[model samples]
Target: MTKRHQLALATALVAALALGASGCSDTKKGSAGGGAGGVNPAAANDGLTIGGTPAKGGTLTVLSNQDFAHLDPARNWVMPTMDFGTRLLYRTLVTFKAEPGKGGSELVPDLATDLGTPSNGGRTWTFTLKEGLKYEDGTAIKAADIKYNVERSFAPDLTGGPDYAAQYLAGTEGYKGPLQGKHLDSVKTPDDRTIVFELKRPVAEFSATTTLPTFAPVPQAQEKGPLYDARPFSSGPYKIESYDRDKKLVLVRNEHWDPKTDSVRKAYPDKFVVVMGLKGGQIDDRIIAGEGADASTVEWANMRPESAPKVLPKPEIKKRLLAESQGCTTMLNLNNSRAPFNDPKVREAMQYAVDKEAVVTAGGGPALTEVATSYLPPALAGGKQSDPLKIAPAGDPAKAKELLKAAGKEGLKVTFSVSTGDKGRAEAIQQGLARAGVEVVIDTVDPGAYYDVIGDLSTTPDMSLSGWCPDYPSGSTWLPFVFDGRTIKPKGNQGNNSQFRDDATMKRIDEINAMADAKEANQAWRDLDVAIMAKSPSVPLFLERKPLLVGPNIAGAFGHPVWVGQIDYATVGLKDPAKSQG
Candidate 1:
């Protein structure tokens, strides 16, 4: 999934930190549990009680700069929306355990009785629904509901989610979705409780894919087609009480929900009130102040780098912060289909010329970004590989110039598409590339629509700013989703921005995908990552670290490692429940 980036803090704010906050200790060394580069294991547990035992029965306010893009599980691919939808409104077949560090990668049963049992040489899988499972409306959640939602993922209209179903499921080659009145025979419901899946090929990690929202059940009777984005039928602990699009959303307890069946979500708060469209540092400011009802608030957005000077310096305020790995790598995507960049030498020159150190500074310094050389995050299998290019962090413009000269494209000109808040990073790249005689023109899109604009092949530019977080802790989620050419489509191809579809690369992907042994597959993926970097389809910028600010009176808040290091909404509660009544 595309990782959302925070806006660049103003130069004035940063300058203030440098000049006036000289006595303050560096924020990186003072993190509560883990180092800035790692996740706090204490914060990533099932209970996630960072601030002690959570008091229940209060309204927990969630502040965000952006609104929910798509609430429908079929359209849920991005992290914030996925984190909210999966933990609150819906339940998947299986889910990752809410533990910190490596333990967070463990997959556990959710609505299903257990992780699916694979047969047919890992091609066919079966899952039995938990007995007495019910929807928000108090109706029995049948196996057909799970099958229907998985089927809807293939619909041309609902095209933004993960492509695992279309890529692996048998008999999905010619089928669209149930909207067109075609049933996916590959997904069979032998009874109300039993569901079976027939795959196009053997996938040993198929059970991990079930943790995605694509596997969440949506009863065909309640389906609203495209309008399901407005309000999806709740199958979890919370039901949508009211929604006002980009402004606000209110969720109340699903009276029909039974905690006995759910193990991943604690659902401690009585209600959830999400406030959207608060730009810049507004959410951070409110939480830092901790006044009245604000004391019970937690944020969905990252803490602004500008606010770090105020919050990170003081022991009291710093204690309320959560700085952790997002398991994402931001990069500059070089269009493999477009001119100038389609040439490998030109792409390599751009890769060498771009300064990752400057890019990191533009993004908010070392506390928020770790210079990344490999596309694979350190959290996943095989971990991060050493830089194949062997270029310095400041970049090698001289080597870039030589490469450009050899390619006969020394004076190359290309447009770089960046979202609204990424102007500083775009400028940093522009300045860096100019040193190698390549001119970059900055093209900006609205922050919310950035992915849609760049994702469409028709509208995408020669180069763009993009980032990816694995769907789970697997190399399959990293490479195949982003680099595999076979998955690239005419529209909604958000994952494969680089569009590298070489025959050799595609063949290697198939070979690695076929491996059943986890250890062997991971090693193959690491080797393939090095081979792909040789092609220079994209330039790895940095690994992201999210710093979150929590209200003083908010308790049990932590950055969930599985949720792209965002605060786990389901686990957070009010420290003082009575104050929220104000």
Candidate 2:
């Protein structure tokens, strides 16, 4: 289970969901203009703009709702830190190209000179460093540093780090982490510049996985057990000047970093001061007010959902509000382990009874979400309204009634386990299903521990609200987490809340994963999304979006295609137009 980001209801209210999300992708309509594999035309970015000359030499104050805890590059999975902090300082072997606006996030080489070359059917891979790379301290970086940094992350203390290497590297399964002196022999340092990885199996999405700073080089001499998070060494444009725990953080230019050595980052702001510990509402108000330094500040945390109606109508305020898919598909997971839900007809009936628009409205409305029909967000190439049951998001209570009657379970008592915070949406679902004569009972769980309560197969509730944000930009992230029965586990972040353990589905996922080309693999996964949805195991509610607010004096702000919708922190600079002209 990925540790998961939280900010909104449970795991999302604290963190943004769009990691490799879409741009101007369709939000309202499902599967329009010719059927299979067809996506409607792209949507206009809701007041989102990108690409401008960045003026330097001012402090960019970030007004955020959340405080970042992870500092060790390996442990950075949270959105605010991953997008705004670690990504600026820790250069990965590969990173997303900094193209602004729609469809801009493409994987490109960062520390390495090019995308890795795969051999032996992608089981073995190699990356060669570009000449001359230095850390913040001007120490020369070596392949051994990358190997050690990757290997040491397996240490128990480094538990929450990205696990791509552990999952894909050959012969690393049973080995203890670096604390126990367990080296991943599969990762070879044949020379100072070249590093090789021997994988247990062909991992098609390995390049995407490398974008995580988990593969960033760490000097063995500077292993400051727990203190590293506060003052991590910089390999990118910024270096830590000072960090006051949960209070204030200031990032200054890393003198050792040269613009010629890096292509992705703009390194615009002379300094970045991240002010922590403002209530969500307070931060939201400050962004709109734009007072003094607040004019230059941007909140990576989303705007208040309560403010949606107020700010929505005002055209001036609307320009600064960016509402885009954050690469997560929020859905209702129908637990297959339960009795009534175990019946296929019952599951199909439930799927037909769902009113996606109503659910999206209850959750936050179009201001914060796009309705979802398939498991994947529609912004992706394969994501279409290819529900396997052919169930439209618009409720079909008569069809649901017919299905329920055919199943010999007319007027069945269907109990749902939903988040207490989502009572309005649950009631919407309950009301819609009630139209079909299905008695929908709402069992509410605490928002903070909803996944825990519902995820427990022991006390498994009939249905629970859940979501899946891809770890990387691939169908492998979206589909496998929810459908691959083999990946399901108790007390873990299992998106397969339905407890669906299908050997056939797992086999198909494996077959698709084995393919090397991304387009082919993603297309296969997209088709699989439709096939799986046809089964009606889980009902997708909406594609999640965060209505992020941008401040006035901030420049070069655009959503990095992969890091959800966080304004590109590296390129963004603080300079009032009046001041910059002088």
Highest TM-score model number: 2
lDDT of 1 by residue, 1-582 (tens): 344443333433333333323453442221211123543221222223457768878888888887887889998887767888988999999987766555667889999999999888888999999998899989999999999999999888876787789888998877889997899889999999999999988887888889899999999999898889888999999999999988999999998889899988888889999998997588888888988888888888766657767775566776787756788777789999978888999988987899877776665555555677777877763444456777777889999999999999878888889887778888988999999998999998887688887888998898888877888777888888789998788887867888877889899999888876666777788888889889999998877656677788888777777677777766778778888863
CA displacement after TM-score superposition, residue 384 of candidate 2 (Å): 5.2
What's the lDDT for all of these models? Answer: 0.79, 0.71
Each candidate's TM vs. the true structure? 0.87, 0.91
TM-score of 1: 0.87
Please give me the total number of clashing residue pairs in predicted model 2. 17
User: How far in Å is the alpha carbon of 332 misplaced in model 2?
Assistant: 0.7
Where is the poorest 10-residue window by lDDT in model 2? Answer: 13-22
Candidate 2 per-residue lDDT, tens place, 485-538, comes to 876767664678888877778899989878877678878988888778767788
Cα displacement (angstroms), candidate 1, residue 249, comes to: 2.7
